[model samples]
Target: MLNERISAAKQIASELHAAQEAIDEVMIRIARLAGTLPAARRDTNMSAIVGQDAMAKVAQALAASGDVRQLLTDAHLALTATQKQVGLGTRMFGAGVKPPSAMFADEGSNDRGVVTALAQAS
Candidate 1:
């Protein structure tokens, strides 16, 4: 049962990551479309003026995508915390984390990786 639950958690995490990536890709595509559209430098006609104003909608879409990004990030963070609570430790899934070579690492290894590696070694 425990093994099944862990497996399920792993699958959920994977799916969550995939969903986040898909949303990001969509935002990128929209942004590229926005760039591809010809700029309306002069509002000489209704079409040009509308084109200029349409960018506001594009900007709103980008802003909405940003909100979605935050939601995905929050979900990821919550899953990480859940992993820690379930005795999964601080190791990143499918990634190796090593402590800094420095004797003391508060300042040295903040970027090195998770400190759990050091704790487990000693």
Candidate 2:
């Protein structure tokens, strides 16, 4: 039974790592696409206010997506570390971990409301 639990944990950790990688890839693609938008051709007239507002909302959604992706990555890292600590591997926890971003500095503690809003908007 103990062995089975350890195996399941390791599998879950692996899945999380793969998911994080996939999310990173998708985000990169999205960033590239966003960069390709014709900003110079965008209308800024009074009649374009609605379009501008929609664009602003899209930008907000993208930022929220990035925040969620970072949180998932962090969860994946934590899970991977736990799996390693459980004798699943000899590798050290967070051997090549990236530094946390200032954007996510208050993630868990202060962003519940924001996350909820994003979730509802989506």
Candidate 3:
């Protein structure tokens, strides 16, 4: 029973990891599509304006990237920790082990990959 629960937890973690990886890949693809700004002009004043605008765009992109990065990091941490907790819970529950609860907290949260993965894992 313990082994089964641990297996289940690890399975869920793997699925979540995969889903996050897919999302990250998509974000990267989109960012690449957006592309970087062209080089600034040689004129100091004109270059300054261009540079400022470019910096603004870069800052916006960085902000967006930071949010996505945070989400991805959170997903990774949640997956690893949840897997460990589920494994521990399995041992604690012993003969009639119960599955981890938090795993279902984000159920139907518009993440098809996640939902599918959870279904497959469970």
**Strongest candidate by lDDT:** 1
Question: 1-122, model 2: which lDDT tens digit per residue?
Answer: 66886668756756666777777787776666455443523533335354565566556766877997989967865665565566564332222443333122233436556656665676
Q: Write the per-residue lDDT of candidate 1 for residues 16-61, one digit (tens) a residue.
A: 8688879989899889767755443332434655566677788788
Q: Which candidate ranks first by TM-score, i.e. highest? A: 1
Residue 40's lDDT within candidate 1 is 36
TM-score of every candidate? 0.65, 0.51, 0.41
Q: 2 or 3: which has the higher TM-score?
A: 2
**Residue 56 displacement (Å), model 3:** 9.3
When 1 and 2 are scored with TM-score, the better candidate is 1
Candidate 3 residue pairs in backbone clash:
none
In candidate 3, what are the lDDT values of residues 1-122, reduced to their tens digit? 87777677667656666766676786676566445443334423355466666667666766687687788767755654564565453122112222344333343435546656766798
Arrange candidates by TM-score, highest first: which order?
A: 1, 2, 3
Candidate 2 global TM-score:
0.51
Which stretch of 10 consecutive residues in model 3 shows the poorest summed lDDT?
89-98
